[model samples]
Target: MTDFNRDALGPPAGLVATMRLLLVEDNARLAALVSDGLEQQGFAIDRYESIDGAEHAQTIAQYDLLLVDLGLPDGDGLDLIRAMRRRGNSTPILVLTARGGLDDRVAGLDAGADDYLVKPFQIPELAARCRALLRRPGNALDSVLTAGNIVLVTAERTIRVNGQAIEATPREVALLELLLRRSGHVVAKPALENALYSMEAEVTPNALEAIVSRLRKRLAAAASNVQIKTVHGVGYALFAPPAADE
Candidate 1:
């Protein structure tokens, strides 16, 4: 089963200063080098070794782009790309397969790849292509978000849990925005602290927890079952999304 979330369908954000990528190459050594280099360039990179990892990733996380190698132990990389598109996923994808023949390139594009690169290629070239893919429109999540049963628009500073609009304080909106972006992932305290205030911005103790409590109550009042959940010694996550049911 495939899950579709509002983040996937929402409008694209303005040009991102940083990006997150899903690298699906099985070779451990190459994957490390690529992942490390991308991290150095200030991009968050997650690597998976098989098609199952890719499938789990499609539902469990989000990506600005996918760097896939054609030859994998599980199955053809093109097959995965086609399946995601069939499910209405349109994140920009670039093929990094070992196959370079014209037919192979044709196959990747026909399978919905935006760009294709033969393996043994220059690392810089691969990075450059990834940058280009991010530049394309509709590759990022929507600027606003719908958390639990509530809809929050950052641009308008308004929140509507179930179609009835209400005012959300700037701080409240910020908190919801962070949780929504990382809908299914637990956000640790340190990260949430950082999100609340930039490195230079002043932050106070218990500020984050207090905000989460307020948001949780608001969501419950909206007839939503506390989508934001806390994990002991960990952090919080928006536990519900379009795919949460699946």
Candidate 2:
């Protein structure tokens, strides 16, 4: 619930296309192909080679969606899925195994997976399934979002710096919500544009820059360490994670 305000300005385009995905597979070639195809579909994918790899991924990586292959070199992929659930990881998991039987699919989903895919699936199908799974609208939460000294409360539409509520416009609030939603990962410009301005709304580039500049200032006021980095030819990311030197 990190408080971030959307700029009054948004991109002229209508499509908001950015998602973070986790991919687990043992087949090197297939994993590469799947990762590439999903990336082309506007998803940021993180891949792991085995159940053991996924087990570690569970600790360090955060994902909006998951693609898992049941056959792993180290052990049953199901075991990893089960382990993740046991640890209270609700990141959506979709089994992509060679097993096509109903019982296998049932077992996987019943084990707390959100979706399942059989082997030899088409790329388009995979993309479509992923979109469907990620379609859930996020609920505004009352819990505080703490990135160091910055805190945000989605329920009250309020933002505080070092425990002090700061004033902001509604536009800034929306922009900040998107940043918090996609925090810990890069959020491209096109996606921000769509979220801010509808496809029907027309916007100028200068306006876009002005809005982001305001957001950057607000974040700075919250903490000197806050940064909204611009990725040349890509988009912007509100990254508050510790710097490499730290």
Residue 177, candidate 2: alpha-carbon lDDT: 70
lDDT, candidate 1, 15-110, per-residue tens: 344577888888888888887776655566778878888889868777888888878789988888899889988999999877888698888999
Give candidate 1 misplaced runs (Cα > 4 Å). 1-16, 136-246
Lowest lDDT 10-residue stretch of candidate 2: 1-10
- Candidate 1 to native Cα RMSD, angstroms: 15.5
- What's the C-alpha lDDT at position 74 in model 1? 93
Measured against the true structure, the TM-scores of the candidates, in listed sequence, are 0.49, 0.49
Q: Show model 2 residue runs off by greater than 4 Å.
A: 1-17, 136-246
Question: Which whole-number lDDT from 0 to 100 does residue 72 have in model 1?
Answer: 79
Report the C-alpha displacement of residue 174, candidate 2, in angstroms. 26
Candidate 2 clash figure, as a count: 10
* Each candidate structure's count of clashing pairs: 1, 10
Residue pair clashes in candidate 1: 150-161
Query: Candidate 2: TM-score?
Result: 0.49
